[model samples]
Target: MNRLLRTVFLTLVGLFIVAPLIVILVASVSTDEVLSGLPSGFTTRWLSDALANDQFQVGFAYSIRVAAIATAWAVVLGTSAAYAIHRFDVPGKSLLRAVFIAPLSLPRVVAGFCFFVLYASLVPAAYGTVGGVAFAHVLLLLPFVVSLVGAGLANLDPELEEAARDLGATPWQAFLRVTLPRIRVSMIIAAVFGFLTSFDEVDLSVFLMPADTTTLPVAIFLRLQQNQDPVTSAVSSLMIVGSLALTGLVALAARRAGLFATRKERM
Candidate 1:
């Protein structure tokens, strides 16, 4: 009875949460002029218009470039730091970990504003450039890599790597042969999260992006300021659908990785 009740309650909550998304999805196809109430008729014109917008195209290209660069750098730096934190004892290890993980807790707007101020004061050229925005994204994504990969490392036994080392393997060989394989799932998860976060980030991009061109989310936001274009709704609907699809893919991947395994299955 309790399990059934819990399932019903969760279903209700999920539906409630997605109510706004459903409305937006409907609005994206609505032929209504006033956009006040329920959709009068269905059409795909808004979606096509949004897709054809030049600013959105430029913003998309920019988002992809920044997300790719940022995620790659964050994975490399964060994975190295995770390994170091797991393998050796060093001075200020706690502090180092804190610094990397701090961004996850800090509000994005505050962090973005701080970085913007620092850049404007110290390096004016970088204040509103693509490189600067990518750099900021890398910083924001570090915590996901560190936390996921560190958890993966912690679940591992040190004896496994030591055994490899004892069997005539060098340090690098032991890591590649034993440690790295075990943490690949964590690395993939981190990379996915880092990419998505960088791609969708708006608050930080708002302050750091160039005046001429910017990220897709920020572009959509600026356009909204001019008028409540139906195109924005269409763009939002696309984003909503994309988010759902990406989430489904991650869930499928996680299941294959045994993240959703039952305790009995794990045993």
Candidate 2:
């Protein structure tokens, strides 16, 4: 009885969470405005129209570039920081860890506003540039990378690296040959999380996007502000599909590489 109740509860929760996505997916293929009742008819024109939009094309490309750069920076910095905190006896370690994860505590709007004010006052030129947006995203994403990689490192046997070092391998070589391969899955997960986070970000992008530039989320927001368009739904549905596809691909790759093997299976 308890197990049946739990299953029912979880099923309801899942439906609640997925209800909005289902609506959006239905709306994307709708021929008319979806405010009143069911769609008048089904059509694929909205999807094509969204894809052909020039602004969307530019925003998509820019978002890809920024997300890629920011994820790279976050992975490198976060992994090094996590490794250091795990391995070394640095002073004020507690405080240092708190500082690194502090950004995760801030509201995105507050963080964006702070960045905007700082850039506006100190380096105005950076206020609306791609580099500035990427930097802000890096700040937001660093904690995820650090925490995920740190968790993976916690599970890893430190003796592997030590054994490599004992075999006349240099410290760098030991890290490259031993430590990194073990944590590669964690890093990949971090990169995907960071990329998706940056790609869908709107609050921060709004403050940092230049007059001539915009991101997909910001574009969607602007479209809604002007009028309700079917194209918006089409674009959103595509993003959802793309994100799911990317995640599926990653899972497939990980499975193929035996990353998901249980201890019993390995034994």
Best by TM-score: 2
Candidate 1: tens digits of C-alpha lDDT, residues 1-267: 999999999999999999898888888899974478878899999999989999988998898899999999999999999999988997899998998899888999998999899898998888767788999998899999999999999999999999998999999999998998788888888988888899899988899977578999899989988988688999989887886798789879888878767669989
Candidate 2: deviation at residue 90, Å?
A: 1.6
User: Which sections of candidate 2 miss by over 4 Å?
Assistant: 263-267
lDDT of 2 by residue, 13-54 (tens): 999999899888889898886646777899999999999988
RMSD to true structure for each model, in Å:
2.7, 1.4
lDDT of 2: 0.89
Error in Å for residue 242 of model 1: 2.6
TM-score of 2: 0.95
TM-scores for candidates 1 onward, in order: 0.89, 0.95
**Could you tell me which 10 consecutive residues in candidate 1 have the lowest summed lDDT?**
31-40
